[model samples]
Target: MSDDDGLMLNFAIPDNGTTTTANTQSKNVKVRGGRWKDRRILKLELEGRPKEKKVKGPNSIPIDASRKRRMEEKPSKPKSSQSNPTSEFKRAKFTETKGEHGGKNDSYVSSLFTNNTASTQEVPEESKEETKTYLPSNAPDKNATSFAGLGINEKLSKHLTDHQRFKYPTKIQKLVIPNLLVTERDLFVKAQTGSGKTMAFILPIFHKLMMEYKHKIGRESGLFAIILTPTRELANQIYSVLENLNRCYPFLVPGIVIGGEKKKSEKARLRKGVNILVATPGRLADHLENTKTLDISQLRYLVLDEGDKLVELGFEETISKITKIIDDNSKIDETKDKWQGLPTRRINILCSATLQNNVKQLGNIILNNPEMISVDREVEGTILFDDDTTGEVQTNNEHESFAPDQLIQSVLIVPPKLRLVTLDASLVNIANKIEQSGESSRSIVFFSCSDSVNYHFDVFTRDGKKFKKVKDEETGETKTILVSPDDSADEDQDDAELTSPIINKNTIIYKLHGSLSQQTRTTILQQFIKDDPKFPHKVLFCTDVASRGLDLPNISNVIEYDAPFTIDDHLHRIGRSARVGAKGNATLFLLPGLEEGYIDAKLKIVHPREENLRVTKYETILSSAFGEKNSTTKNKFDKLGNWDIHATTWHLEVERWLLENSSALAKASHAFTSHIRAYATHLSQERNFFNVKLLHLGHLAKSFGLRETPKNLGKKSSKNNDKFEELENGGKKYKKEDPRKKMLRLAKLAVNSTSEYNY
Candidate 1:
């Protein structure tokens, strides 16, 4: 038997008997076997013919003898039932039957011999199962899902997808879609910029628009949705987002109405029955004023983006007006008949990075028990991670100690006249420090007023004058003479040539104030952020105008020429720096005398009346002696030597008295009463301290007399004692010298230590 033939035999036959047959016959062998223990063996086959010979002997092939004997002893083949045996045999031979392998082998044989067809069959099953499991069970397959999956119907889905947004919904979309779909509940969502917050609201409103379009309901002859933004720039941005979405979905048409843009086009679009309107309150209010038939009674959803800024920009009044215009129900008289179609229940949504008290109040009036979502801290983490691309958080401790563990505060005292000079020197020194330390170039200088800003600008420019030019001319003769200019000009030109050109050479410098025309302001601002190829950094010198709602990219430094009056303003100013994951620097310029303004000025003369009285009496005596009233001898108060009468009098009358009454007990004794009265009299010389009354003076007299009992003093003493204790404790916590108080005391000391003779 050959390997190709499907046969296996285990038998014993005679092998030793030799016979030469004249006629040789080939016998066909058929084996009938039970199922094998190893099923894999059934697939094997044998091919090629076996040798044809006759031999008589016991076969040497090993077999189970008992099984073979049993098989041999089994009954012989049964007689055929059909009379035409040959016909039956032919039919049986031709007909297909199960081979020894037990099942049809066609499929297995074909798979083994085929090319890529085998792989194709196996791949789709696993892929299909994987894809099925990957999709969220509650929603349809994300890949095949339309905007409908995001709560937007087919009409909106077409528009949104047409805008090339063919993917899974963003995180904000996932949270907002269902809420907007199910109810008109007010939503407050706080997400970072570029987190797709605009789409979150747009898509849901799109769904509502499509619903209204399809059902031919809720038309109400008015706009359906109104989106209020803080700035014209932001309003335009939101308009663009909706416009793209509207293009994708034919049912939606959004119009933008903001300041510093073409009004006619926007008005025309709005008149054409816009489903959504994105606008700034000021401009939209203007439009509503002119167009009496501008109906918004159907306004269903109101979105206020950057809600904090809207209030900060003084838009609350305008916003209220616009909302009142749209909310006809609020305006209608109770006695009058109700409008034919107006939405009674409107949804108000407000979004902002920060929520202030005014914003909260606005929300209370506009939104109905709205939910508040705060992403400030969470977004900070995202920003930090974004800034740390190398996966290592950078510490800003070396320059400005943001770390709580290590803090160092310094106090600098400079004369008022030298303030500008000191500030210039300090900036240069700080710049040097940054360079030497290889730290980031982040620093800011805070000025107290706009005048100081101009002063510093002038000082800095003057300091940079060594890099400027100068010219010199030689004396000329009678005839025409050509004189060469000084080499200094060439040197300055060379230095200027060597110096690096300003990084933002084409940057437009603009001043932002409330007085600028809206058009001029818009043009300046647009130029500042114009994204021109030639310029990148737009330097803006503003007076708190750019503190809020102005989102500029790549701002590395914030210079506060003046310190903010309040801590909140300080936070807002520094906030302009270190925004959107960028490192920033802030510098504060404080002059010596400037700090004294924050502190109460102390009394200069401790015994002004007594001192003046003594001087007056001396002048009287001098006048009596000198009949001529000599100018030099008029007072002798001036040009007083170290041992002069005035000096001696001041020492004995003021310093010595204060020293004797320095102790608390001594100060409370009867002996010190006269000194207290005299000091009080002196203090009263310039102006009465706290309008001290005779009764108050008597009380002071009694306080001075109570030496034995320290606690016997009235409530005033107790309050003083408590304050003293607090000061003492606070002083101990600080260094031996309280830098702030020391600076103030030093200023007072400087004034007191000066002499009238010197003046």
Candidate 2:
């Protein structure tokens, strides 16, 4: 064997010109130079030792030839049914299934869930089918070609098709019109929003009156119908619809009596006589008790439009009183014999989009042997559902409230500091889209209070000015800010190119709220609904005044700048769009952190039939609004820096504008204060998600372009000092009111001052 098979040792020693001899017992050893000539050897003394070898263990043993051959010859077996317990549980907990619409059925637990059972419940097999309840729809009937098919007279049908361009009736109209015309039973109709519920009842009343005109049905034929609405705006809209339908028979006069109108004028009109009257609950109740000329004995139909809204607005007591008074005054039943087609007794119809408990109570108060008509819903007969086991009343939670499927609902979780800048960017993006498509777009941004609306409207329409930067002298950080009209003489200056107003010149902004005069409210609403081709992009900044019953066409987008106080309000805010089968978009702005939890806790299951809610990235919106500026370097941080830079610059300009304009600053401060007060008024159940105490005061102030701290904005108004007279002024001296009592008084005032238009 070669000497390499044996272990060998080597050591080094200092070179001293001495010869060394090698003596070994085995012949396998070899020796070389001993003066450390070979540097690779260790420079230490060592006793020669052999290397130890490791013994083979079980894991290191090679497989037997027979077993290897058998394994290679046979195919591998499938995995067994049993799996690790923890892994099986994980798979069971998070197994996602594809819905019919291609959305994933998220089975993961929500972080907002407080119930332990709900969070840790065992998931059922997705393959097993579960019963699903569908909400109501407003889809038009393809088979019913014309209004005549739904029992409308020939004249009215022709006018509808040729004049109004209403060729086909919706599903609600098809069901409701025939029932009203054929039978005298009262109706409680529940249908989707924007589903022509107005025409559903209007046509039947019109057709009956027109058919009986030869029998002396004229404008002087006594008040035949009384339509009660919750708001003046809706009452006005109903009157307009009635006018459009009256073209077939111009002699059938319809008049409106609502608040914000002169009672003298209404009384004069009532004396002149009107066959049909449309009025709000409060105004109508007043006319019923005060005005004797307003006759209701010959009333054939008492229709309650938006019955749920009326009840929600605390009009139930007024409605009940009106109905009782009318009942006590019904002495002309003999006159109904002459009107052959009309109902022998006054017919009561309650209409609403959803059937809540309050609406059901209102229906019970109005309807007599009513037919509950809910098209496209699975339930039959009546909407008064009862639990089978407990015999307790139950509202259909599945169809409690919902948005149209065509409405694209999305949400953006932006930090409070970025809300104002993001809002500007979003508007710019929408305007750009309208310009690109060459289509007119109407957008509405809803705020919490009128002050907020006022402040924001001023910010946008400040003479169409843009913000610019200048150098600061105190900080010496090269920071300067100024504002001027975009078309100013300084257009050629370098500052002009820095930042322009987010709103376009073609944009028209309108503000409407309860504080405005009635005439102003009517004028603005009329102008808003009227199409203006000159301004393709129209934005209305208002509170909840415009949320219900008013049908403004071509409303392409809705932005909820402030979260609604309740889920019902949220539904109504978004219901402004995607009406009558038209496509639209709704965006909700939510602050980061707890506000984000509102999505899964409340909004996730709002619509039972489909999942349309999506979370949009704020950065993408920012990019679309403010186009990317030219940069030398491109990276993640660089992109973030660009967004931050643009937002800072725009906000700086707004701050500077506020500094110069004292009036605007005052409005901003009031708005900031009112917003906090309103934020506390959210419903108790939803308070956990929108707690006012959790807000970052400084950051929220930034959104309103207010640099002052929250404490300064929240100071009590000094104007109230006039109420407390001094002893020297010859009036009784008064002590300062306790702060707690003052706060309680203000809170009560806030609650009591809430109007239907604002709240």
Candidate 3:
């Protein structure tokens, strides 16, 4: 297959379930990262890793943070004889956190913008309008025959077309796969979430493992490929993908060993000698310590899925221990008494949706002569600052194919006070639609925490005896029930009007959170993924645990019941539905009504969003009935029962807020805060350091939609034609005065020219 760019693909692969042997006799065949560049990979011959005694098992791994040595800041001024003034580049020093860890004080807490009342600022006409999207690349080609065209083995290509049915390769897949086969470089892949990144690394690693195994250079076998991810669910998902592909090459056995699963079972699987192991770091380390059958000394390929998340301090110790154990022992022994040793050489692939600086640092530690490939622009390890003019917003690479083209963004006005009741309404409607269509509906509702998830689950499953609504068998009448979102156990059983809730049919809801046992979560995921027409878990309420790496198929809608805290979270949460070139819908519910605090919350969401995502927009669907200060929502009482005056009022208030503030609310995360966390309050200790704040007046202006106002020239968006819009009388150009000239004219040479402060 060839694209319009004239890029031809090679699909010839093995049809028989047979492994190809590597020709060891071939002389110095070109390898990618194996033939390392001096500058790309730092030589450790004279900088050997600190020597340590051999760790017999995982039990020997230390949990303590590895001590990091800091290079002291140079003295302010070196003596004249020792000073050098000609250095071309300078580096900044790391900040010191030595004394801040123990201090707990209320001095830093401030209600930066806790507005108690409503305030409105008229936005400029130009500012009120949205910007036009810029497409820099030609449209994607969907006419490709199969994955084989992208250089896959023929059998694999046929399976892709006949089984997986992926007719074309994604942008990252096209860029990554070809390079992996042709070049022998360490891989650092940063594709957007849901971009089929798992395959990008898996295929290459599988191919290499097969080739290397055929040549027989490494030891007669243990696991050849080890995929380490952060969470259990993610590990399972990666394992599933690997298992599916392994069917073609029946010789390869893939297994998963994640936390919370039985270690005995894991050992049993390992005892059988699996060809590939997908695991979470903690458990893998544990088995490595206690289990006698586990061995990875001959490991050929090491893949870090969601590499950015796993490279953090929390998992750093475990990862370092694992890598050290797998590192060649002979090379280390050669330099045990000296500071010289050979670098550990192995195939390393690090993958993530967002590659921050810390993740880059991790690549330096493990990868040699790595090729850094991303589907989008750069992301960060640290926060961007208001004064950092060098920083740029996340841009869409016109060529990137990971972003779902048909993803539509929508917002449903909802109040925190009536969140559950409103959720019930949404679910009831969704179920009705699914029944009418005779197809299963797949929707994920994201919450802020596990507590919220549990609370909502109870409400959904609760059979009302007290707070539950009662229905008349003959008249078909029902009663409104009000249950606290936080405490679903509260019910007024004594009320004669309140009756047991009629069973809601076709409402097969599943809950996923960190608190759920690994086995239970796995079961729930299985039921949810069940595509059988008979019964399926349709609705899933979860936290961020399900956001990053889990790929649930046929997810048609992603609903955020609670607003996301961070911009990246928002992107990943919605990414659940619009995956693998499929169109999907996302609806976010905003909780804060029309108030200043609400706008402040909106600012927190928007700033981060503007930094990394630009091509998407949220449709403000708030109707006048859902307005502010009105706590009542229709709450679909007509469907369940007569709505409580208060619940109905609150529900309407949510709509009113959205309707009244549509201009601000439509910006999605950038324009609102719908959910509030307890830790966000000033009374919370941990809230002090991470609370969002406006850095400067210009930042505040930008957040409030005044970024393009005449005076705030510090920031500008291409679509803000402020000057053009402000033109009066035939679009005549106004002679603008330079501030520098104005300052000079107003100052009148303040001091005597000869006696100025400067020499």
Candidate 2: what lDDT? 0.70
Reference-based lDDT, residue 185, model 3: 60
Q: Model 3, stretches more than 4 Å misplaced?
A: 1-141, 211-220, 329-344, 377-405, 412-415, 464-504, 532-537, 593-759
Cα deviation of 533, candidate 1, in Å = 5.6
> Candidate 3, after superposition: displacement of residue 715 in Å?
45
Q: Which residue pairs collide, candidate 2?
A: 470-480
My TM-score estimates for the predictions, one after another, are 0.40, 0.72, 0.55
- Expressed as tens digits, the lDDT of each residue in 1-759 for candidate 1 is 426555664433224354423233223323334334222232222112332233221212234655566767998755553422211111111111233321123111111011111111101111223211111111222554445665567655665556554455654556666666666567666543333456667777766655543244332345777898865556656776776765555556677776666777766766767768888888888988886545665567889887766775577788888777777544333312332232346788886544445556566547654554433332221111112234333221111101001111122322222223233333434443444454333233443333223322322331122222224356432332222223353533211111111112222234444334445555555555545343333345554545543545545555554434433344445555544333444443222222323212221111111111010111122222222324667433222221123212221222223323454234333222222222222223223222212223332232222212233222112233345434656744334554333333332232233211110
The best candidate by TM-score is 2
Candidate with the greatest lDDT versus the true structure: 2
- Report the lDDT tens digits of candidate 3 across residue range 373-479: 76554321211122226433222222122344456555543323334445555555566556667777688988765645654554455343223455878999996
lDDT of each: 0.42, 0.70, 0.52
Candidate 3, RMSD to the unseen true structure: 33.6
Residue 543 shift from truth in candidate 2, angstroms: 0.8
TM-score-sorted candidate list, best first: 2, 3, 1
Worst 10 residues of 1 by lDDT: 116-125
- How many pairs of residues collide in each model? 30, 1, 35
lDDT of 3: 0.52
